[model samples]
Target: MLARLGAISLSLSMILLLSMNYGSFALVGFLSATGLIALVVLHPWTARLTDRHGQGKVTAAAAGIAALSYAAFLACAHWKAPAWTLFPAYALAMGSSPNVSGMVRRRWAHLHDGSTRRAANAVEQVADELCFLSGPILATILVTSVFPEAGVLASGVLLVTGMLLFAGQRRTEPPADPAAGRRESSPLRRPSVWAVLMPYALVGILFGALDVTTVKHTTSMDSRSAAGVLLSMIALGSAISGLAFGKVRPRSEPRVPFIVSVAALAVLTCVPLAAARLLPDSLPAIGAAMFAVGIGTAPVIILGTSIVQACVPEARLNEALVWPSSAITGGNATGNALTGWIVDHAGDSSGYWVPVVVGPAALLAAYAGLALHRRTDDDCVAAEDVGV
Candidate 1:
């Protein structure tokens, strides 16, 4: 129940906050990038707090703060606040965004050991995919069909409610570990961790490009009204994969699925490019292509995350999880900047190719990371075998 509420809260908040007047896509992108950087910098600290105090307390506090930020955004919209003021406010809100998915996975790890843990992780992944799939669609309906600010209002309510509920979940809190809480591993010293993080960073770039591509394509097709529907399709695809993964028996070779998923993503990214040629001028065609892309996305994320969790130490799990999340944020920033520039100069048609190029690059990076990760430790297991 708490997990459901938490997901609803985040979904509501993102739909409300992001769907607002994005006067300058470039500015919004830059601000988002800054916000992601802030999250990255603060993630380890937040994780440390969770480790020491409890995941519930930290998550609730973060969600509550996030709720206030959404409320502030509602105020800004009402008053027609200047960009200067709004940007900082939005940045602060984004920076403080809860790493809810990571926290949930950590709890799953805590609840189950060995194979059971992997199954739990898979369930969590499915939950995340379902949230992503549903959250935006609901938010979009409320914002577009009802009122622009309705999304924000809904988000604020959900955040406060969800976080409070999540905090109350007996199973959600991290186990008390004074020693683990006090222990610190200098991020700078871990070259092995960096190797895994680099590819994940590339994946983040893909995320950013994808975000811009989706928005630009939908707007260009004059189907901005259906943007949420398009995004939901993608999320649905992921949720399906996650559910299937959870029920499957563990595999001995996790990298195989990871590599296969990235390769599929690379192929799927070309859908946009293909749409440009095949449909040439059809909005429906573009939407169809996007749905296809969504079909290929979920397994990649779920498997990639599972591998990362399996590879990292239990003690450093939260910190390790933050790297991937930060990489995603960094990618978003880069994609937004690049996409914004392309849209400004070239036209929306050119924007379609960005993911086509980035996807392949990400595939290569993922393969390299997998190879390197395999060389590190004796107990380092494959993602499939670990059921991650």
Candidate 2:
């Protein structure tokens, strides 16, 4: 239920905000960037609160605050509120971003062991992708068929309902640790945590570039209506890949998937550039290529996440997980903002270049990490022998 609430809130809010005034690309970009920053800033506090109090209490509070924020946004919209009022309201709504994935992962780690834990993590990843795909379409229908504000209101309702249900579940809430206080004192001081996170930061940048570039490219080629479809295709592709990957048996070296996924993504990146050259004037052709590109996204994300989960200690798992989320959000926000500026000043031709540059850079980062892993394989052998 916590996961469901988080998904609904995030999906509904994104679709409503993006679809309502997508014509104003600059404003959308600015709001997304700022909102992501606000969320990233609040993450540590959110994690700390959950650790100290409980996942239930923290989740309930965040959901309630998020619901109120949505309500305020609706009221502001009704009253023709200026940017000053709306901006804060928007930031507040986004800032209450739920740590649903992290929370679930922690719970899974606590309840399960060995291969079961890995399977649970993979299932969660697939679920995340599923939510991303379904959430937007639901939001799109609500906003377009009913009213724009309706989407926001619906988000609040879903958030409240899901949170209440989740909070009621005994097993869903994590068991309280006697040493929780000491454990939370200084999580980031560990070197292994940083080792797991550093590469993800670079991957996050690539994801961000891909997300914004896809949005900008589709909107330019077709219409704002097409943006939702394009985004949906990407999510759908990822969801399918994640589901398939999750069902597979565990391998001796999980990094094999990680390496393959990143390589595929790098190669797939060229598809857009090819589309730009070969079908320069064809929207349909570009959309097809975008969909194919989406196919590689989920596998890369899931594999990378699996690698991180395997690398980190159980105690530091939650803290380590937060970095990837923060990195992705930060990357997406920065990439969208930068791409928006480039498109505005440099013309549509500049949009294709975003992916072209980011793709190779991300691939290089992944390979470099892989190289480091190989060099340290002898030392890691004892660790891997134990089986995470």
Candidate 3:
């Protein structure tokens, strides 16, 4: 989760930093686009590497590269280097980011199965929500209160530090399954895997768009500092619900909760529009709406992660789970670039429309998955078909 802090914190910090320093959301978005491309391109290779080598050795190597990348990015920012230089440097940093969050889930899955796994997934979701809850607030506060460079610097520090610490936790690492290396069935080739991943890709877009838009929206009102707090409200809502969700037992198929949460998220996204229309100018009102919209975020995430864990075999868990993480970061990259440009050309208010539009698209993907796979409630049973 520390790596997540670095990633998300960097995103929030960089979006504001690049836009404020460069005064070009289009440029910022373009930079984010490069990152999105790099992440997607490297997805399979990274997953395979983790599968073959264990998480610790791979993560340590990645952490070293990431440290160098962060230094390069900071140097560029400090010197006001040519815009062209930021793209590769930032992409390297983003692309090399270790998936410690995914590793944590792997650890939990290693220890538990059945109803217990659900609880662990719920806790993992809560940890994620907490990161979201704290990441922006910590990042922005540092940037706003300390030095303009402080947020990115702090994010980099947390990322490197968190990763090294996690890498050292060798005891909890999943046993290196030798057969996993020889497995022919890639998670990408599975229809059931894609069934869950597709809707999540849109969900990633929703999260990314929401971040860029919220910052732009609050910044427009001269309450730029309030951006972190309003953003935290969204995480706060999710964290609260995540806690409650952990206690309940599943009553239906995994897809049922998946669809319900997506639908709720799609519908609650409207709360922001309604809040804006009614109050027209209150930051508090927008904060309230953001919190409500966040309510649906965790349930969808918790259920989605649980679904992936259940469907994929233990050997391929890393390969399969990485896709959802990829979707989020890749989607975030897409959201940042797209919404940043929309805010630049159209108007700040236009950024708000992104989530409203993307939310239902996620719901559609969820329903489509429902029809396509129709997997039973026994989705918890592992499917090992692909390793032919």
Residue 147 Cα positional deviation in candidate 3, in Å, after optimal superposition: 1.2
TM-score of each: 0.87, 0.85, 0.94
lDDT of 1: 0.66
Predicted candidate 2 versus true structure: per-residue lDDT over 1-388, tens digit per residue:
4345344445335534553544455665676677777777787667766666777777777877877887887787656666557667877877785666787787886677666766676688777767666666666566666776666677667766776666566666666444665754444553333434555565555555555555566556655445545556656777777777767754556565666777787777677668867877676766676667767877766655555566555555565567667767777677667766776677664666777777777767667667666655432323243233
Task: Report, for every candidate in turn, its global Cα lDDT versus the true structure.
Answer: 0.66, 0.63, 0.80
- Candidate 1's displacement at residue 85, Å, is 1.3
Q: Local error of candidate 3 at 115, Å?
A: 1.1
Between candidates 2 and 3, the one scoring higher on TM-score is 3
Clashes of each: 7, 0, 1
Worst 10 residues of 1 by lDDT: 6-15
Best-to-worst ranking by TM-score: 3, 1, 2
Question: Listing every candidate in turn, what is its Cα RMSD in Å to the true structure after a full C-alpha superposition?
Answer: 3.0, 3.4, 3.1
The true-versus-predicted C-alpha distance at residue 227 of model 2, in Å, is 1.5
Kindly report which residue pairs in candidate 3 clash with one another.
Answer: 185-386
Residue pairs in steric clash, candidate 2?
none
Candidate 2 wrong stretches, greater than 4 Å = 1-23, 77-80, 184-187, 214-222, 280-284, 370-388
List the pairs of residues colliding in candidate 1: 204-331, 205-331, 208-332, 251-384, 251-385, 254-383, 254-384
